[model samples]
Target: MASAARPQGFTDDIVQRRVHRQRDQFLQCITKEKVLAIASSRRPGLSCDYFKDPERGSYNLCCFVAFEDGQRWVIRIPLAPCLAWGARSKLEREIATMQFIADKATIPLPKVYAYQLGDGLDPLSSFVILEYVDGRPLSATEVDSLSVDERARLYELLADVYIQLRRHIPFHRLFDDLEGLRPSEIQARYGQRGVLSSATEYTTMLLNLSDNALSNTRSRILDQEQGDDVLYHHHLFRRFVKEDWLDKRLDDGPFVRVHGDLQPFNCMVDERMEITSVLDWEWSRVVPVQYFQPPLWFTGHSTEFLALGYPYLRYLERLDEFLRIMRELEVQKYGDDLLSQEWEHQKSSGGFLVANALENWTDIDRFSTRHINRVWFRGTKDAPKRIETFIREDPTRRDLVERLCRAHEIYKKELQQLDGTSDPGDSATTPDPFPRRPFFGTWESSVPGIITTTLALGSLIIAITFGVWKKRNL
Candidate 1:
């Protein structure tokens, strides 16, 4: 069967072109002889053909260099924009993570042959050469197509990998150690420190992506409605940050080394359905153990798809089986029930709730308050009461609540308009209620200038206030 055509607005043409241009420039910097020399240590007299991977990644471009003898290697070039945005150190961190896992864990990963940062011959290029594993990414359709026995076998393989990953002890500090790499040098290269220890620190780091840094630097031509959307998200996030109850819960666990990006596409499997390799460890970090849950792709539904109609419910049987398998594995390894512990902790801490909230903030429909309350506050009736105190005490909290209410009203009106329904409440059942919008076309037209100006002013005020507070505290 042929792959379905990607929906409009789903393509990353600009990023793709940038990646291809960088690939071409890096290829130009070296001759066939130079390429042969780089691989000569592993494969003598290695003449090769190079082709870029058709499936493009967000930050790196992968190219296959196949030798005449049928041996293949993968060269991953960090895209120029990514490097400029401090991804060189991220790449280095990934290399360090792979090396550490190779030494400490039983999980299979690509063997890194060589890595290079900009030098005299190619001052702007950075790439990693690794042994190529011949396997395809396991898709949701592929998972559904598998036999029951085959799916079980695949789950076992994945479970073994997960167990090993979790069993490996976390580093005392959050940062991975790359030999001969200085902390200052790493910070200089990345424009920020690499390490994180506490949950507050980790949450702050993730929040920074939505903060003034990206908002101010992002192209002004982006959709105006996006500003209001962002403000709405910030309002939700501020609750998590300001409420001591939420912050303490967020900060309530021991750090564990986690494969932060473990979506299905990152895992490779051969015809036998055994995991051949796991790719992309750039975002791996020492985070709280509460984050070390099952892969989000197990349900075979994206968050966007979930917002449409809770489509993941169609895979409920499979999800149940997957959870059973995980629970059995966890019991065998740790002599405790995984799901029960996770559920108990989630109820008390709302860790997963807050995480899902953060991850799906941009798509509020997917992370609605009703869903969060059902999942995280199932047995507790004091949910509103818990936040009630914060709303009463903090003027900022009250302001955010008002902003959130106003934003939701606007969102409902937009949904009603799209659905062609007079009653906004009826919009939920409207077919294809929220068609995907282009990234640059996400801003609202009415209040773009006002939102931008307000954000800038607010950011400046916060910066000044922080400076004064720090000085006085010191």
Candidate 2:
């Protein structure tokens, strides 16, 4: 293949600015007396069809070059400054981990050529030189573009990949802290009897934290106080949930690696309809022995203006099928009984969204465009007219849904009983109580006390005044 010329116009300056940092990082990682600077040729026929803003601006700018010796390689320069808070170091370590897995693991992950931490163009920038796999990102469009049998075959191949990865790479060894420990030793240290045990613990902690955070945020909103603590707790909870959930549920299991950002778009299918390559390991982590079902965007809307096809629901269905296959595989490997046990544990621990405060839920209904808030039954014309229409048409589903809604209403009334019952007189206060320290922690840590104390003191003058204030505002 002939080497293409440099891309034109404004893009030229951007490339020129980033090139120095790319080369610098390369030199730093691989100290060679002599280095060959690959030409920056713009590869045609591909575009980044990213729906969301690529976080950290870590998009790769590369030109596919087939050298005179008929060697095909991609020279990729990653943009974005090294984040101040040691994220660059974390990323560098991750790159090393990926290289280690590629070389040692049974699975065929990306082969890394070189990783360099750069300076000049984008200081704290990093560049990775890798062997470019020839394929397109996977999505419903790409899957539908293939024959039905081909799609099934691709999924089967992916399932096999998961099985092999889980079997070969034990979860404890994949993460930090246990990098040097033998799997058995690490398991002993964590008191994890097996992969499932660790996963259950991790998932349970994260969900509980999320529940507490959401509960606190709801309380603050109800009291009409814009306390920074409430907002901070919510943010912290979201972060913890994302990290812990990934670690325990996805990263802990050797079976399914949480391909952190997998949503079909990061997958690629070759001419043979096989997944040629999985792209973007930026968010990739070892996960539970399940198929990929990564989260979607907040609004979960697709950009129609972009020429690339968008089939959101179809992609979700495909993902669900993939997860189902993994679940079946896990059941086959262990027992259907074990899978059921793990699932039941997950439910009891609130691994899934169980309850929502009526007020908070109403806010979501009024605000969110995400599918979770999709209307099941509403008289509004603004949203999609499906659930109501379905209820109007189907007798059984409508009746069952109505019964469920009534039950939910009853639950709501039951919750209100404890709203104003707190009485501090039940416990005496001590004098000079350490001069009340400055409040500076998260809502998760504080809101529980606030709610409890507020209710307990409702008979007091202060509590009565606050209640009157709320009523007056109402």
Candidate 3:
């Protein structure tokens, strides 16, 4: 007998169909009719027939169920084998966390109607029933057509959410109880389940998470040079943390729950200059205040382009404006503006780099390119030379890097085997930090520079040819 094959990812049409099929299955017992049975469980006698088309995200597939009683609810079905601690457990945690936030914080969140309870939801044991938020996600190109003032107001609204998540959440009581959980379980849920004594402990836990993410081969596409990146990345993060460049007096106290993926995509905004509801609470966790910074959507591009020019410059202007809004909101709310005090480091280059270290630890190549290659060395052109100089220039840094390399490689290999991946035979692996991009193959990240250089060379050739033609005519 042959076993069924697994999906490459949820992106495939077949996998998406299966997800839709699963939602359909939840509607009824194929053998029996349970259409009303499902809705009644959420709310007694609330009949539902029309289900909106499924909306898919990286981790979950959601379908909006509209009841005849003018009620709408969403069924969030977890994609199994989901990244980090499996899908079922992660979804359960998200449900618990969302419930906690809704009760404690004044933030607008979708209510969880039925999860891990009720025999009516037996078919959807793997899914959660949530209240459907009415609004559009700001990242859905809806905010682009907004007027300048509208955009400013939008940033202010977003800053309010950030302030609410940090300020209003009753995390102190939760931390005091600590869930009666073991230190490992506590650490699993929150970064500093115990109070972080120093920067090293905090950053080391970040690296550990990155290593765990890498150990899971399913989290990323198999890159041959993946292991090489850890040496430089781990070294730079630690060194910067030790110096005042990163984690400056920010650890040891007052850790709060951060909306881990606090971007426009996860935030739903209405036309009335109000943020209706914030979504994607799965990755949210309690961490040091410094980890929470301005959202990435403010950067204006997918890749973090620290280089000056078209989009990066716009990001700087928007970022300052956003921070100004946050400062004002903090003052009004707490009268202390303590949250603004920590973000002073966030405006620095070291802050952004260290931030990438904490957040993008799972994706080391991205951290290297955006934080180190782009920001530190300027661009791809100077990356190799600058990186070599950086490692070799300082003896202490060099020793630290060597230790990181050995540790990263050994752990990566052990985890690789655990992921059922054999040695990739990467003896021929190049020291190149950045991998081959999709469209351009080996094309440089500096596209504007390439275009400008091409035009300059074309002009030079035309001048030389014209001069030769004049000499021949003479």
Candidate 4:
């Protein structure tokens, strides 16, 4: 399709400023010839313009290149010498993975317009051109502005996206190759005894976070002085999912071909609130489900979905939306009963396990400060006086705490049992599979644009919900 022209408020000069200021950093990595080619090839009718992305800290610099012809593209140019080696490889893998997903056309993913390596600019100055998806990010805004319907719709959309990808993508096997390490092998290398059990060791290793910051940082957000306590919360969340039967049975319980980074920033929407495109696959990975699940650190409260970011509101909503879409697609492909059973299994086995795994989250101290005080307390308003009394030093709340602890324990036990039955070393380990054909065409056609028109509607619905809730509750 031809590019749309720039909007009136967005002047060419303004666009140029945005490009050099934010997008030029990435462009700086490319050669003068390559830049000229990209710039010269600018579609005459394109509407969007290119601007550097200041938010990224990775190898590739991102430029928002939009043309007068309405061609909005997020061009990525790698700064490293080797595109497929070391940290740069991570970005390469992510691009490959996203390209793979985009070809499927199953969900709303931004289309990959063009990609090339060996440009002779930098040793590794590879570049990828992608569709410029429209819509404001859900994460950038406040929740109170969203309505109930929007919240529900957002959840529905999120579920659709997750289900589509999960059904088609064998995440575990992908990670095995991408990381060049098998699940059992990883466990053996990292596993420890005692204070660090099998699961705990794995969590520590795979969290992808530095040890000193999490374990030794001076920050005292949680009442507990120990970093392990903080790590424990993350540990519990991951373990809950990893130990579940449904996840284990699929391949590696913890791993999948996930959006690896399905944060709000990656998603795009149209004016109708539909999902227009899911951008940025640089963080895509075949990692553990816990790694992909939204960050659910609250003890008892629910925050507005957008603010929770990854593996929290966004993750859950994404997963939820994916499943819904998968059900429809599966029902069309196979039959309704098969999908029904799958959903049942997920909810009863893995989904229930997820809830159970989160049981420990109610321990007030384990929750992050935002979730603990704001979300948790707000959710338990009915029992606020009693809860408050307990917080103030009453011993009775200890039992409630114990109950939360016990629930967490039971959930943890279930996960352990799920894990015990499966051996990562088993011969029948799942094989990693890739699509045989190029995602779009025989490698000649431009990948179709991924624009979910529903996201705007979803966001608007949430804004409405917030208003209604505030009016009624206040």
The residue-by-residue lDDT of candidate 4 on 1-474, one tens digit each, is: 111121111012222222223333333344434554574464433344335332222234445665665556766555442122333344445556665675664787766676554445353345666666667554524232456566546655665676556556543222222121122333355323111222233344443222221222222222322222333334434443344332433334434455544555455655555666666565454444433343221112233222232325434443454455556655776465343345444543224224222321222122332233234345324433433443446453344344444544554555455456565432122321211232111111111110011100000000011122223210
lDDT of each: 0.50, 0.36, 0.50, 0.39
In candidate 4 the C-alpha lDDT for residue 160 amounts to: 62
lDDT of 1 by residue, 112-204 (tens): 877765533352356777888877776655777788999888887777777676666544434422211122333344434555555665555
The TM-score obtained by model 4 is 0.47
Instruction: Identify the runs in model 4 with alpha carbons over 4 angstroms from their true place.
Output: 1-37, 41-60, 67-70, 78-88, 118-124, 139-153, 171-255, 288-334, 337-474
Q: TM-score winner among the candidates?
A: 3
lDDT of 2: 0.36
- RMSD of candidates 1 onward, in order: 13.5, 22.4, 18.8, 19.5
Worst 10 residues of 4 by lDDT: 454-463
Using lDDT as the measure, what is the rank order of every candidate, best first? 3, 1, 4, 2
TM-score of model 2 (CA atoms): 0.43
Clashing pairs in 3: none
Residue 187 lDDT in model 1? 34
Q: Candidate 2 lDDT, tens digit per residue, 57-155? A: 223333344544444554444433222212344345446446545654545455665555545443225555566676655554445566667766776
Best by lDDT: 3
> What is the lDDT, from 0 to 100, of the residue 333 in candidate 4?
63
Question: How far in Å is the alpha carbon of 169 misplaced in model 2?
Answer: 1.9
Mind giving the per-residue lDDT tens digits that candidate 3 earns over 1-474? 011122121122222333444434433331112423555676766667546445544455566678887888776655442222334555555776676677667778888776542223354456677788877666524555777788788878777777777777623222211111122532665554544544445556555544433333231322223323334554555454555454545546455677666666567777675789888776556655565666655654653344223454566676777778778888887887766666654666636545644554333444445555555556667555555666567675555444544654665575545445453331212222222233211111111111111011000000011222223311
Please provide TM-scores, in order, for all candidate models, with all chains considered together: 0.62, 0.43, 0.64, 0.47
The true-versus-predicted C-alpha distance at residue 288 of model 3, in Å, is: 0.8
